[model samples]
Target: MLKGNAYGHGASVTAAFLASRGLPLLAVGDLTEALDIGQAPQTSILVLSPPLPEQLPLAVRHRLHITATSPELVQSLSSLAQGRNQKVTVHIKVDTGFGRLGAAPEELVPLVKEIKKCPYLKLGGIFTHFPAAGGDRIFTAQQLNLFLKLKEEVCALGDCDDVLWHAANSAAFLTLPSSHLDLVRIGTLLYGQSPVSVGAEWDFRTTWQFKTRIVQIRTLPKGHSVGYGRKYRTKKPARIGVIPVGYSHGLELEPLTTPLRQIKHALGQGLKGQHFVFHPMGPLPILGRVGMGLTTVDLSKTPDVYLGDSVTLSMRRVTASAHVPRIYYLAGKVKCILANHEVLSPTGRKISLLGLF
Candidate 1:
């Protein structure tokens, strides 16, 4: 379920579930992430990075669909594909008003013509990244106007029958009405999260949950307190659960106006960077500052759970997605996993963790 902390839900599991659901195509921001999931043969890929000649051969072997915007990139890829005897399928990006990637609206027609002249090169599609689909209607409309102008010019140029038109990303796909585009490349949404998913009305629940067993616990006195600076002074003798995870385990604060925090300690002014695995009574903020190597959680209201008791923390992407570890399951069983350092899967009850590769 792509419903919780992305890393906790397990990347391999999410990848597998996406594949099983017939949503096998994934669009990634760069080559590294594309490479991480590249081993999954069932998943077809589209690399959002601009074309690079040196990387084209690897992209060819990996069967990665790339995005190209200029005559230079198209020319470089055309030549490289020819030298390697491999055909390159590329999606053309347009500069609409976004001024990011893609050629200007006026340049789309001529560029397409030049690309068509390359024998080993295949222009697979046309796509534009929305600069502000969820907000800023003025800029989006201006970009739309430019995109429409390019579309009109291309259709009049010739019948480019095989080209696919795609523009909507996760935010636009949900907020904006679909148009003539053939595909909508989703990123944050597939993990059961989004930039706009807020409040109880938000449909996506986190697909990940993080849990760790108690390492050790000590009964503290009322005035002595616990952890550095003695920031938390217990009102009564209380049993607090000790979990092994800390900031190194990859936790983060969600974006503002988002309900993604789980553990609620009395929030100190210093908690901008530190994060934990659980929420507190009545939405307690995080504790004093996050320690360099360790973090303490306020457990006054944590309950009577003893050592070895499971303490779990849940998260959603209220901010951007963070790089975290994931343990994947199938049918409620651990089938595959993505750790900070390895990729592994279960085959016939035997687990395989790719070592250092």
Candidate 2:
């Protein structure tokens, strides 16, 4: 899955690399994202979301597979494909348990029949989504059973024998192996994250890192106020380093929608005493509230730390701003840098997106 800008790791670069590794098909969230890749990958691209009526022409013209969530969308695609004298492959999405963006189980048969009536539309696959695959095994199993039963009914029509059936997301890919049907749509696992824990056999290492350099260093006297609202003050004379990263870059940002999560966040904040960033020498405590674009760190403990030294940060990858530069490395060497929507080599030469791999 190469949606959400490849989960904020930059889709163009990620798609090129994955294509080089011989991935036959890539999936994205929408038609716009499919166009964003711009022929960088030599593979079939599937749009996993239903396309708008206005977007169907572009989708069919580009030969991008689309997910059919309703009979109305299927009809729109059929008309566009017939007008263009082309065939469009569509995967029927059933809302087995995921309550969003798919035809209900009861509606799948009629939707399938509707697609079969359209000569320009071809049924490439049928898939469903899991809402709680990681935490709820029984629910996921029930969803799978429901999908399989519906699949049996769809196959009885004799036209969908060649249709691919997929339902496993990353969580289900790990927890419920039975859900892995003809194909599995894995996003988080490809990014080296697992919603469910596995044993030692599954050795998944983190594939992305967020880092920033110290741009400025300063010394502040006792009782000096720092950051907005003066939420923190120096207890004594201390050395601080400033990094050009904060909430805007997804640092220290998390969802606190539930009361339990909010309470857990509060308890975690109290237990940690102070937020810190990682360095080879040791941890550097944050000095004040994280700003929108700048954060202050206490560097008194790491006397040898200097300006331009890089420090690793804890950030939600998907929430990180796309404006931030992503430096890709291979075998301990800088491979390419993705910044401002361009891919460049370490020597500052512009690299063709098609030739990235």
Candidate 3:
């Protein structure tokens, strides 16, 4: 799915690359995101979220597949398609276990029947989402079983040979083989994020990196406090490197995952540094809480590190800002750069990557 700006990797760039590689389909969150992929006649774009009643016309006009969550939505889509004299493709979102954005399992038969009654609507696919496929096996199994049962019931209604039934997300795709019915909607895994413990075994490589350059360097006097709330203090004279990135840039210094984990980390870091950023020589610890547009890192360990040196920070791909420019590399050479809706070559000349496909 090329949603969340392809997990902040630039949806248009990733979608075009995927299409060029013969990927048949791409999924997005809404109509606006669907239209961001530009015009790709050969590839099918599925809007996973149910569109508003008024948005049906745009979805149909754009030839985008949509999610049918209720009888009313199906009816609305059918009516819109009929008015336009076009066959609208739709996927039935059966809520097997994920308590969000899908019709209940019991509503499957009625929803399918409603869709079948709409002559202008085509049942393109049926799917559900797994909420705990990575951590809870029993719950995932239950959800899978429910989805399969509902699939059987829906298929029995009419000719469902062309309907694609899918439930596996990234975690389910890696751990649950049986959950892979007809299609797998990989998200985090496609960007090299694994929610499972054995994710390292998969031959997936990271497709994104968060990088910034040091803008300033300062020597903090002993006993000087750092950042808001005066969280960190310098015991001795220390060198601090300021990088132009922080919460605003989606670089989270301290990700409070769990209470227990927090307690463990707090105890472990007793008097030592907490979060760190990467330098070729060694790790540079963060001095304090991340601010809006600036972060201070301890650079005492490396004397050679100076202003304009690149610093790499860890970040969640989906949460990163979409405004960041995306530089595409082909075989390790810069091929294209996409920023603010403009496509340019390495030398800054306007170009079209669409012709390559």
Candidate 4:
């Protein structure tokens, strides 16, 4: 899934890399993301969400596949395609249990029949989603079974032999083999993350890292408070370093949904030792509350570390600030830098995504 800017790895770069690897079809969240990928004539791009009626022209012009969730949308798309004299491929989305955008089970057959009646519409695929595929085995299985049964019914209606049937996301792809139909829409696993455990054979490397240089270094006297809230204070004289990364850069941004998680997050804050940034010498502890654009790190442990030293931070990629420059490396060498919507070489030459890899 090349959606959510390929889950914040940059959709253009990710799409180019995956296309170079010969991935036949790429799926995006909407029409804009598909356009961001530029023109890849050899590879097909599918928009997971239904397009707005006015957006149909561009979608057809780009040959982008769209999701068909209702008879009304299918009819409008068919009319548009017929006017353009082009066949529009559509995937019927069945809402097995995701409770999101898709046709309900009882509505599946009628939707399929509606698509079949359209001369300009081609049924490309059928798919469903799993909301709890990671932990709820029974519920996931139930969803899978219902989707499969719906697929069988659709097949019985004829003209579904070439229809691609899929239901597996990254989580379901890892834990449930039965849910792997014709195609498995995997996103997290492709980015070196898994929702479930896998055997040693599947050795996935961490593919992303967020790092910044130490902009300043200073010392705080004993009992001096730190940060805006003064949430932390030093017992002894302490060395500190400032990095140009904070909550704005997705640092310390975590979702505490449940009460238990909220309590755990609160408890973890009191343990000052828990927050640290990585360096070759050792980990540098974060002193106190993270500011909007700056964070102070306790650097007494790494006295040799100086200004301009780079430190790696733990951050959620999806929430990371887009204003921050992204440096893409290949085989341990800097290849391209994506900054301010332009891709440039290390030597500051403009380049295309095709040349990035």
> What order do you get sorting by lDDT, best first?
2, 4, 3, 1
Whole-model Cα lDDT of every candidate shown, in order: 0.62, 0.89, 0.85, 0.87
Q: Which TM-score value belongs to model 2?
A: 0.94
Off by over 4 Å in 1: 1-13, 51-53, 194-205, 220-241, 253-286, 314-324, 330-334, 340-357
Shift of residue 343 alpha carbon in model 4, Å: 2.1
Estimate the Cα RMSD of every predicted model relative to the unseen true structure.
5.4, 2.0, 2.6, 2.5
Candidate 4 lDDT, 3-93, residue by residue in tens: 8778778777778778878889999999998987786535799999988888888988999999989998999999999999999999989
Extract clashing residue pairs from model 3. Answer: none
* Better candidate by lDDT, 1 or 2: 2
Worst 10 residues of 3 by lDDT: 193-202
Candidate 2 regions exceeding 4 Å error are 256-264
Q: Estimate each model's TM-score.
A: 0.76, 0.94, 0.89, 0.90
- The most accurate candidate by lDDT is 2
Per-residue lDDT tens digits of candidate 2, residues 1-357? Answer: 989889988888888888888998889999998987778567888899998888888889899989998888988888898999998899988998888989989999999999999999899999999989988999999999999999999999987777999999999998898999999999999998887778888878778889999999999999998898898899999899999998988888855756777887788688875778988889999877999999999998899999999999877688788889888887879889888888899988888877667
Q: Give the worst 10-residue stretch by lDDT in candidate 2.
A: 253-262
* Tens-digit lDDT string for candidate 3 (1-357): 889888788888788888888878889988899888777546899999999988887888899999989999998888889999999999989888788989999998999998888899999999999888988999999999988888888878879999999889888988999989888888887877776767345787768778888999999999999898899899999999999887876876345676766886787578564878898878889988889888999998899998999988877677777666778887888889888877788999887767644
- Report the CA-based lDDT of candidate 1 relative to the real structure: 0.62
How far out, in Å, is residue 250 in model 4?
1.5
